[model samples]
Target: MTNSPVASPAQTAHSTGSICEFQPVIDELRRALNSTLKGKSEAVELVIACLLARGHLLLEDLPGLGKTTLAKALAMSVGGRFARVQCTPDLLPTDVTGFSIFNQKTREFEFIEGPVFSEVLLADEINRATPRTQSSLFEAMAERQVTIDKMTHRLTPSFFVIATQNPVDSHGAYPLPEAQLDRFAMKLTFGYPDRASELEMLAENIGAADRDRSPLPAILTPNSLQHLQDHVAGVHIQESVLRYLVDLGTATRHHRDVTLGLSPRGLLTWQRVAQARAHLRGRDFVTPDDIQDVAAPVLQVRLSGDFESPQTIIETVLNDVEVPVCS
Candidate 1:
């Protein structure tokens, strides 16, 4: 792991007390992902934060960039059930949320679960699915459950989705709706690897056997993950820091280039993400640095405007808003 060392899991935990006792586990998770993802250390960290915050992730990049590998690595690290749905134009909503089957022998209906029932679901090339099929995920992503036949089924407690889409300009791809885009906690892109990392990858490829296998090791169970999420919820955010957060959201709304600013749900999502980042650093309370650290990625996913790029618009918003100094 080439990334700089974060706060020692031990030092910061005592200061933060019981609310953040699981910092060491998060540190371990970060190191594991860093090793698994190779040169994309920063992206791995953000993905871990998104998971800790209990939010879904969206990966936008070209094919063969290890998008699927990253998702699998995260799922394996937690020993979570990983299911994948390959989205195509003909995919139906029932295909994703599953359907009821009639048992001839028993003369009763049995509801067979779909890929969405797993803890970590990888929705690959989600844009290829029809809009109706895509809409099937909205309820599950927002409420962590699915509704079928006027009956609801609860997803796994650690339900986390990693949905990937090719660039909209690509043929056979559909642009994600604004509502669908908003459900993603953060959108990340993993570009080509650096020369050194690519060299390492080549070496690994040569050394591997005919069958490729996962290198990720499970470090936590579902219950342990739920506990860590509980701790993330307890990370403190003072009134001043929250006001600063609100200020950024408000500024985005008033930005001339923006057609739609951060929604109320988006703002709340940002706060939880910031809290997760802080908790990962072994801090119990939120800080402006934490907010700034995550501002670009979080805002980039949901913000829309007339700007040249979402990244540029987010950078401007960050500059326009004043940072709060917390004692």
Candidate 2:
């Protein structure tokens, strides 16, 4: 994956004082999603934060968990072009990144864009695809560009992928390698809804032929979202907080239960996610709590350990690390 010249988000944000101006837009986007994805406030907020952070997501859960609905609602709320790719064992790399087609009359090869070209792409049952097919997303996810036949095609600036996998069925699934896993900023699971929410869903469905078929209002355009991402880059981080973050990363590396530790890329993404979370809460600077709040989702995707689950390991790291004093 080759990187092309684009305006640096950090530089653009620094040119302005801070990202406080975009708070209203962020809040509105959150509310729009919240209204549709009921009873999953935390999941919705994290999904929004992941977008603002300019990182991909991995959703691991059972079927009928509304993962697809969440992805659709997000795309609708942002007013971005949405595409879905149903991963299968026979899916080819060319099918995902696109291939050049021969034009008979013109005697020229034309490029056909794949689903990945869209602003929002949902890779459903990603693990069901073969490893060869799965590797197709690495470049697109990391550099936002895909090289086909030595020609590189750039994806939209706001391109985001939400890949989902069924946790229960691993028989025919290919486990995502560490490299592929590292590309995702966070991995989350949306569990079953609470009794009250389920009851509401049932009651509403009983009266109507189709339940909750209302369309989600588009609150932000692609350009507006990119601007918000740039603004999020301006959120502040104190020196003490930086050191504290480093300490947590280093601790993950040396933890007894872990086979693999958080990579530098993971650490950087973790910081960006924390900043985004702070921005969502209407703050310009990140706090230790902000980092803590996002640790489980961020670290769970990257950390591999033998002693306990990733979430438990992350929580232990949080408890052991001293929170930096912020003025």
Candidate 3:
């Protein structure tokens, strides 16, 4: 967590896992997530990468897309306690980070835990929450700890937040402050499904309207998942590829449209995310392509600029940088 991701993930990483040992679980996770959100294999790949990378994700899209479903599926696949919070204008800070209440019988104040205690948390319509309430998650997401009433509470080391928000241009939506956005590693969208995937979904739902489908069995225990994360953190990156990542980061900082460019911390997050992408592609070494593939979404959420479309800035930066050749 010291902004040097090459040495470790967000936390200390150690594993007794080999690639062969992880294949089955990774495939199971892929199937479960892919089925839950159909016709989004590309997005599914990114979601898995984010999980293995041990990073939070921000999902921005229109309503009724599979944002909620995808969040649920990811939690279920990871085999963890999942909590959902429906953000609203009136949500209080204590409502998210929990509050202290007196136990009448013992006469001692009890600290009630909130959604941040869960391994996977879904913040639905996050922009609807007031700034103070949203700020409740900042410490938890970044440092894996929450301070309440001058006492610090530690969350699960594997804690991951998947926050979804409607487009900023939508009515009643509040733009997230840059500090909040920087906490997330990637921002993605689950766009509308293709025709075939939609038809299959409708067919499957026809007879199951009132039935609650059993979730997929846990493909990985916490230990196993930790091992996969360790593996991703250990994925090798060539010196030239590291330089390439730095070059891309510099481009963002120097861009004319960028008001607040990618910070050093964001650059470290980018390094970890790119490592996850390489692991997902079954590679032990990072490549220039891995960095470029994740550039758009990883940069989109954190970069503050005057540009209307974040994608345009990503394209321009990617175009401006020269790809480094690995020796």
Candidate 4:
């Protein structure tokens, strides 16, 4: 969970302007997400940072909390090809990775791709699927490719999976294995909307002629999103801040409440997310504040232990850890 070493903000700006130029895309995404997702600006911003960092996300919450809507809106806002697969026990691996069919005209087999071929995939009710079917996404998520009959098919450049699961019930659901959970960059919960936001949702539904009609639109292209990812990678992280990140990760490992701490991959993801957060704020270099802002979301799922609520546990851990001051 430690942060990596990066250049200072001044040094990064002096070296290049790529980070500065990518701000508009982040701004547009922020605005679009804010419009559709009222009263959840922090969650929306974290989701955008995950995308800009080329990381997958897991939205864990109860049913009908706008999880699917948010995923669809994010895919559309990035102008990426979006597909949704309702995960069920009967779903097969081939249903997601596609299968080869005999072509009479060509005298050979042709592979008909599946929903996984899309740029952004929404795996709704992911826990409802059998472990066999759930394991099917492992290859695509970790390697960005699907292997079928010894043939490997690479995914789109901006391939991202936003998976959703209902946390309240596990009666007929198969919990994601720890290994699979680790593949996700971050996990977030969309709690119930406040009174005012709930009222707005009711009002909006009252006037809508059809349920299919939604106001969200494509705001940014895939190419631009890829560029933004690159820009985030180039953002500066000072040595002191990097050490602070390292200290936090180390603390998690030694914390009495934590049975498991973040891995090196988790640490790298934490750093990347922090950099992306800084870029979203129109900063070329990352600050400790950026690390602190992103730490809870990026590391929450990575920490393991007995706690009343994982989110609350992470918040408590963050509050207990003393943030190192930088000169």
Candidate 5:
């Protein structure tokens, strides 16, 4: 591993930290994806933020809502290798992590990498796969490595999995187990586009003669992305905000609606995402507001309940609990 130090002192200032140098890169990515994504700037930003934080995303929405498109756009924007896996009921664990194949010529078992080896992997209709097949990703998402035949193979540095599932219908779908759901850093819903945005999309399609004509261009290379990740890790997070994040995670465990709360890993993920969001906004340090802004998406799926809306439950809990003041 090569260590290249990037200085960010402006980020060390008090209250108002300096903006990250990668802000321009983030802007270019947003512009590149604007035409293809139409009208969801917030959703696009959240996805990019997750990627910068080195976290996985879980998109739960109705079909044809551009879940897969967003994943592809992110992958393209980073110029990374993209792979799509159509998970099914009969899909096996070996199919995802790849099985050892015997090479007759070499007379030795060779491991052939699967789609999971790519930088960006889109697991479309993930719920369609059985629990066994779905669990296959647990190791890859958590450890960034796949174990087969007692041997482990490390995945690419920018390995990310964007999983999409249809929430409207559960028929022929196996709900992801709790442990698997915990691995996702954030869960997002891409609702139907508003009338104006929908109209804009129609007009663009009509003029281009094809929907894919103006696909988003690559704005950053994989190396640059890894650099951004390094920058995010260096972003300064205040002790007050850190305490608040810990308090928030502890509060979730005691919430009435939640049977289980965000784990320590989930809390760390939340902290990292908050820092990433600040970096995207050209800031070098995190704030309470940043924590609040990212708390919903970071903890929504990790904290579960039998409430009407899991997202609503999280929001309510966050709103009701008082954030501890740092002395």
Candidate 6:
């Protein structure tokens, strides 16, 4: 709310169409994703919104719920390299961020790039990794760079992480520290699909792609996707909406049940994802609806409460604040 003068929603006309020009690519990405995962359109939309916002996703779900499939589809659709790490208790920090190895021929310790170097990194069962290993990603996720042996390495500009955790297994898993939780933009769950969707999944076979004559194509390059993210960043939000956002954030902080509320960083992420939601709706300007629509997912990653579920506490926080009426 303090960074720049908030523009009128009506002034957003100039911000339109940049994202629309890439509609064909977005549509194809959606289609390819649906073919891979049936009856999860809502989850797919949230994933796209998170992608355009350039934020990390934390997926908490049971095994075999298609979390990895979704991540792979997204990575392929963008035509970026996909890397997966099945995190375990013994997974080392060097394993995630890479380490220096002495090369006799080069006569130097050359850094070996790890899974973090890829554009799309799937840290499957991330909670299973030790905290020391998990902390290695904090810098890369936050700064987009890693420092090893006094040298810094920059990650791909379009780097996106989809980290998953299994809630059922607690014996060897370490609960993600709050600091790690705050780094992700959203924590989503891929619940089992409905009965009809289950039947559809039963009938899906990638080998049958030839029958449909449609295969997944690289819908957009990493650079092009970065441009689209810039367009999403430009979507305008009125001053009134900023105040509404601030109010909601404060309400969460003051909520008796919540021990840790949304931070300044989290609030900024909230604004960004709102911009993305508006862009996803084909609008150049953000409305109050955009803020509320993404509130739950955004809040789920940041807010911590003692008694109630995040959804219940989030509903309370939302009800406590008044949504702005935009012209």
Top lDDT hit: 2
Clashing pairs in 1: none
**lDDT of each residue in 139-172, candidate 3, tens digit only:** 7899999999899999988898999888745577
What TM-score fits each model? 0.92, 0.92, 0.92, 0.89, 0.89, 0.91
Give the alpha carbon lDDT tens digit for every residue of 1-327 in model 6: 123332422122233355555455556667888877788888888888899899999999999989888888888888788999999989988898999999999898888999999888999988889988888887888888888988999998889999999888888888898878988999899798899989876676545664674545677777777877888898999999999999999999999988999999999999999998888777889998899999999999888879657999888888879877898
Enumerate residue pairs that collide in model 4. Answer: none
lDDT of 2 by residue, 98-160 (tens): 999999999999999988998899999999999988888878999999999899999999999
RMSD to the native, candidate 2? Answer: 6.2
What's every prediction's RMSD, in angstroms?
Answer: 4.2, 6.2, 5.7, 6.1, 5.2, 6.4
Which model is ahead, 1 or 2, in terms of lDDT? 2
lDDT of 5: 0.80
Off by over 4 Å in 3: 1-17
Q: After superposition, how far is residue 5 of candidate 4 from its true place, in Å?
A: 35
- The deviation in Å at residue 327 for candidate 2 is 1.3
TM-score result, candidate 4: 0.89
**lDDT by residue (tens digit), candidate 4, 185-276:** 89898798889988887887785676668656666667666665777888888888888888778878777778878888888999999998
What are the lDDT scores of the predictions, listed in order?
A: 0.84, 0.85, 0.83, 0.81, 0.80, 0.84
In candidate 1, which residue ranges exceed 4 Å CA deviation?
1-20, 210-215
Q: Report lDDT (Cα) of residue 228, candidate 3.
A: 76
Per-residue error for 159 in candidate 1, Å, reads 0.6
Candidate 4 vs 6: which has more TM-score: 6
